[model samples]
Target: MVNVFEQEDIMNTLKHMHKWFNDGLINPDAATTDQGPKWCVVSSGQGFPGAEVSWATGRGKDVYAEPFAGPLYSTTSILGSVNAISASSKYKTEALKYLEFVNTDETMRNMFAYGIEGTDFSKNEDGTITRTENCYSPATYSQATYFTLYPVAPNAADQWDKVEEWNETAESSVLLGFNFDRTNVETEIANCSLIMSRYDKELYTGTRDPEEAVPALYEELEKAGLETIREEYQKQIDEWLASK
Candidate 1:
């Protein structure tokens, strides 16, 4: 654990990192740079379907990876986004049918997931798909279930299988089932957000020193009702725990 206030520890680490970055030794957006520095990092989703397509289509440079961190356990696996046909829509039934079709029908799902196949992507002899040179659509299939989408290369054919395996074995948080309803605490949250946004934009980006800035940030947050916000969340969490 790091003592955030300690100048020689966390603060020094930030300063050194900022200095290296200023000296051009460190890359901030290391994942998505088109410059193709000797080394970079990207998330799993970005690594496979993202950079692969960019490199293939001449839009971005190629880079290789050696694991910097690996096999980490997920603390939560809850779906943060929900997709559904609106109940008030006139075509609600049709919409539901379409939703069902997309989830259950692989062909339809692939059509939606990857766009016009041969134009947007080409099927390889090995069964993995590659993005076409003129494929304008971005692969953002997170809106739907991952399993339903077609497996695009340079992702291994078994990538989805690996994802499922990892999820099955991953750790769960103690607050797994707890969902905080902020209806009663919205004002406090908004005020706290204002304070956080004002400071975090600079403080986290190494533009502001942690020593002078973090304390002031906290002070502003407290004045903005962060304590009240925390208390309300804790109250809800306690009720959830007791119910569990």
Candidate 2:
């Protein structure tokens, strides 16, 4: 696959991005909104509905589904944002019991998922959930287990069964189990991060012309030892692949 920032590719990509902006196909002012490409890069339980509803609400005139261009890859490693109970908790036994309760108890799970159902939401005759008027979900992630959370949208309820199928069928990453220890490259990593932070927003959001920014970004990353970081990461990846 051609890197998006490569000299040949960057100019063309930026040209299209600029045209999209000029033609109102892209909204830079609302770049952080749920409808933004950045937020909807991949379908998510939360973002997908918001993006769909944007179309229903007359906000997604230019929005259309596009097929992903490249091969799909899922890391062998599991990904999550929630924290488990700490080992040192004073209520360790209680925490363990709570974990067991949430995992096994349907009523508790429903309560956590729906949030006092009559107030926050109500079940339709078809068994799908509809949010009550003037009510919002209380911390979507904190509700039930993520997987057990009831779908709020009609379409979502229909597609819920495919979530596991999609996850299981994704192509596994080549660098699956390896987590890079960047201690030796800490300085390089920090400098590269800083460089990306300075230029990434403008470049990624198409707020600035790539003709001027790309070379400068590359120059800064080079000075910041991006090559060294790449070499180190490649070494780890190669070793990981060999092991597998």
Candidate 3:
């Protein structure tokens, strides 16, 4: 909740980025060009271990991924994929039961995730799955527990076990499960977002000097009521801590 945008460490990092950009170490079109596996020599994104297999296979090139830092478990990560029942739903109980069934029943979970078993995919004798042509491949993680879904070939059968171990060892954030309600600061949040959109991309991508750009951005955010938003966040966080 603290406004760390103007902190020394952040400023230093931006300064380094600016230097890199000027020295031609960073892509010249970094601020404007679209970047992805197919577009850039290097790109950053979130993915679990062993995800490179799929990325490599899809791109027909060797793709490797390494974590820059250890995993940190936080509210954002925990809720990255979630199922929510509508507050005004008439069948809230049935919805809850259905969600429970999806998470608990392997057959139901796989069907919901990968489609009809024989038609979409076939189970291997060694326990992996082979997806057929025109297979229904939705975002599997969002559907149910990853452990319940059978592993596709080239990905280890114990990949989910490794993920579980990774989760177990992840450092838990103090703010885990602390939801920040932005209802009171909606106007300020909107205004600040607009202000940030004008300057953040250029500054972060090293298209602008942080020394001059950061101050300008900060001033505009303050004018857009950034302090009010910060204060509201701090208040909620403090109350949440007290409850804990």
Candidate 4:
């Protein structure tokens, strides 16, 4: 609910990542070595309804991209939505339909729930589109807009069914059920997020000089939850993975 990334540096960094995405730099198959700030690019559609609509409505573009830095942490209310549905015994039938509604609704698209219609677009004489927004995405700390977006499959553009398919992949990917008991390190986790907010973009976007930037992040991250958080997360993840 509270936007922790309301800082100026972060916004600019997101815009910078946009430049690379439009250039076609991000690829999923790229080796891990190629996945960072180098030539790497992060790409996603929209997380917020307002933004998702905006991103998809351009005239003729097949795909558009947005950059990221943070994984865009989710509020418990948001992530726990599926859990509540499951508990209520409606997750299988009702919740899935709702997700479908989110993906294929024209009313939702016109509303720009996806993102603001980028600046370069206009209706054409043939009723097609004439858009020129050239935006790119960065591979670091980008968010799908707001965490509340839950558009279903068909809500995507007529030409972009693959995007919806990809969503299924994301939804079905590993790490579905597991809980984080951060009581021992809640402060550290919050603090690390707070501290990382300061340098996430500047360092990754090349504006802050990575060498100087990373060290500062480390010092603060330690106070926030560096070792403890990682240890705890890893410990939990290991147990969860083993159970699976």
Q: How many residue pairs clash in each candidate?
A: 0, 0, 0, 42
| lDDT score, candidate 2, position 243 | 79
Ranking by lDDT: 3, 2, 1, 4
Between prediction 1 and prediction 4, the one with superior lDDT is: 1
Q: Number of the top candidate by lDDT?
A: 3
| CA RMSD of all predictions | 5.9, 5.2, 2.8, 13.6
Q: What C-alpha lDDT do the candidate models reach, one value each? A: 0.64, 0.64, 0.84, 0.48
Angstrom error at residue 214, model 2: 2.0
Better of 1 and 3 by lDDT: 3
lDDT of 3 at 101: 95
How well does candidate 3 score on lDDT at residue 244?
A: 91
Report the lDDT tens digits of candidate 1 across residue range 1-244. 1224445666776676566556766556533345764433432332322435444434344644443333333223354335766778999888888777777887777777777877888888876788776575654654466776656777677666666675566556667677789998898889877777676545544556666777887788778877777788889888988998
> If candidate 3 were superposed on the true structure by all CA atoms, what would the RMSD be?
2.8
Poorly placed runs, candidate 1 (over 4 Å): 1-59, 63-77, 89-93, 115-120, 135-143
Residue pairs clashing in model 1 are none
lDDT of 3: 0.84
User: Runs in model 2 with CA error above 4 Å?
Assistant: 1-4, 7-12, 21-64, 67-77, 81-83, 134-136, 143-147, 242-244
> All candidates' TM-scores?
0.67, 0.70, 0.83, 0.41
lDDT of 2 by residue, 116-207 (tens): 78888887776567776667546655533545555565445644455545545556565545678798799999998998888776766667
User: Cα lDDT of model 2 overall?
Assistant: 0.64
Ten-residue segment with the worst summed lDDT in candidate 4? 137-146
lDDT of 3 by residue, 137-185 (tens): 8988777788787888878888778788887888989888899899999
